[model samples]
Target: MTKQQVNKVVLAYSGGLDTSAIVPWLKENYNCEVVAFVADVGQGADELAGVEEKAIASGASSCYVVDLKAQLVNDVIVPTLKTGALYEGQYLLGTAVARPVIAAAQVEIARKVGADALAHGCTGKGNDQVRFEAAFAALAPDLQVIAPWREWHLTSRPQLLAYLEERGIPCSASITKIYSRDANLWHISTEGGELEDPWNAPSSQVWCWTTEPEQAPDTAEHLSLSFHQGEWVGLNGEAIDPVSAIDTLNQIAGAHGVGRLDMVENRLVGMKSRGCYETPAGAVLYAALQGLESLVLDRSSQDYRIRLGHEFAQLLYDGRWFTPLREVMQVAAEKLAEPLTGEVVLKLYKGQITLTQKQSPNSLYSSAFATFDEDDVYHQHHAEGFIRLYSLASRIRALQQASATDPQSGGTS
Candidate 1:
């Protein structure tokens, strides 16, 4: 579809610098009514405040800010957690997982408002563009996608800022805000600035969600977590809502410097990028859940579950959340989590969370089979027959070798 065909467009607005610029550009370039759609996926109140006013000031006909926190936690975060989905074995996939939900919400808003096209501020170089476009294709294939960054001449931030300034569009963004951050209930990620250089260590200022390991208090904090069918249910036996529970743990764990990851990850666009992430609560939760899995899952089941987790992680990282493969893998993960109801005690100190104890109703460990002391349940002498049978092939090999060396002696003697 050509630009002239679009009469109405729905933009995934974030009230950020790029998105704030996109609103006016869409109106000027397309000469169409621009509707802004924002998904409140737990980015926090500070970012959400006056967002509608900002959208309107930038030339949007109307704005729709949907509360997606509960759905995000239940439908995306919880299921991903059950699969142990961590991108590159370190990232909890906080940013990658949130994009599909945001894009899906944009499509929903488009349908409601009778929009003809969908637009987003995601850059052509990033993974998010692929993620959002993929979802748009799956959900609303008929809608025209207007990715301005890919089509526009405004290549640099300075140019984009100048464009907005010339139009008298009020924006709060400045060049001084060096780092690009994405924050949610699960984690906070920092990119750009000094983080662009892999050799440069992340300065203390780069971290907003976690304390510095050096500054963390020496005293350790112990916490208990309860799970029901792989979903976190309680903290210290007190039931709490999913978003609140994650927030509570983030505060508790962040104070102790429990989660900080620095890695140069391979991007889906075929390039490597350096990023720093702080997933305080997710780190603690993953550790606790793994401990619980150890207590309940059998050896073979555990092995297969881990393999499934790796694949699920890749699928999530690649932005295939809406595909059948993701659903199938999630179903398998849920099956593994069926008996994973339990409680785990974790000790947090200086960026480390160690499992102290774990208990589950489906536990396979038995003292009778594991004890060093004498017990009637497991006869000590039974091991002799077991070992002989286990080594029968080796014993036969040895006898065959001896006979080969003395065939004539065997016949005469």
Candidate 2:
């Protein structure tokens, strides 16, 4: 790649220590004007407040805090839920799926600001670098891509602290920062520190969004969730928007510590990393929607949908969200969710979500046909013929094997 004559650069700025440091570093190293682009994907106001001031203080020419909460829920979260795309059977893909939406908007900001280069604060060892760069290549291949962690000589925290101090940058960060955390409306994940050791149990200090399971209330709580074509529409018989619905569930579910997952998952970069996640709303939604799917989808369709979901999960985990295969699989998953107009009642108790009752307008379940008691709809004798035909090949194969081993019996033909 040729050296880019970068006059201005647009950066995906989170106003965190890494990105706060990146703004001035871009100016010093590339000698370019820096534009901070912050995507407001419902991470919360505390993280967003004073961000513009911080960006300017960090030597950015201007800052753009683009609101993407509605778009993210509609475009990314809902569609992902349709496919049941859980990474490695544990993760909800909260950060993995949120990257594409953030990157696409960053590209737009780069073009709007007339910046010739794109910069991100993702480190060399993580998967976000590939996610951001891959989306950049697909969206704006002409822009120069700069990842500071891959090129910077300052590898240690003490060096970064000294560099920031030299630049007169005020950061409320310390070398003793235990966990690396990322949060959005969907979930919050914690990595590094004690999490690096798989044998070490996650302490109470590691959890922020949820109550400890043992400390949860003694009595269980029941909540009803309604879904229409995979989008959560109602909660406890009240119509609510996607954002509000998720927030409500998060509050309710978190109180009971309904969503805490500690697992070691394989990253896209071929490394296994341990993390603890709190996904209160996501856990409830997954259980309720799956219950609805069981009521709606037929036997063969259910089988195929489960297989397709696993493939889609891999695509999402690997940061292939913008590809044609993602679109193809999403369309198929949407088709399977056409009958998912139902309400599911779930009991939340001590970090467990159990599907207690479910009712759907398009349910495939029939009590009359399934009853063990006498029913006019189904005859017991008919099953004998059905079983005989179903096992005919097995019966014939067994007889042939027996005759081959016993030549005297084969003489009768």
Best candidate, TM-score-wise? 2
Q: The CA-based lDDT of model 2 is what? A: 0.89
User: Against the hidden reference, what TM-scores do the models get?
Assistant: 0.94, 0.96
The per-residue C-alpha lDDT of model 1 at residue 255 equals 95
Output the worst ten-in-a-row residue range by lDDT, candidate 2: 404-413
RMSD of each: 2.9, 1.8
List model 2 lDDT by residue over 1-413, tens digit each: 43348899999999888888888899988888999999988788999989999999989999999988787889888988888878878888888878888999999999898989999999987889999998898899999999999988988787887888899988777977888999888888999888898989998889988999899999999998888988899988999999867877889999999889998988889888898998999999988989998998999998898888789888877878888998999999999989999899999999899999999999989898798887887888889999999999999999888887886876443
Kindly report the root-mean-square deviation of model 1 from the true structure over all alpha carbons. Answer: 2.9
- Tell how far residue 43 is off in model 2, in angstroms: 1.5
Candidate 1 global CA lDDT score: 0.89
Q: Which ten residues in a row have the lowest lDDT in candidate 1?
A: 404-413
Off by over 4 Å in 1: 374-377, 381-413
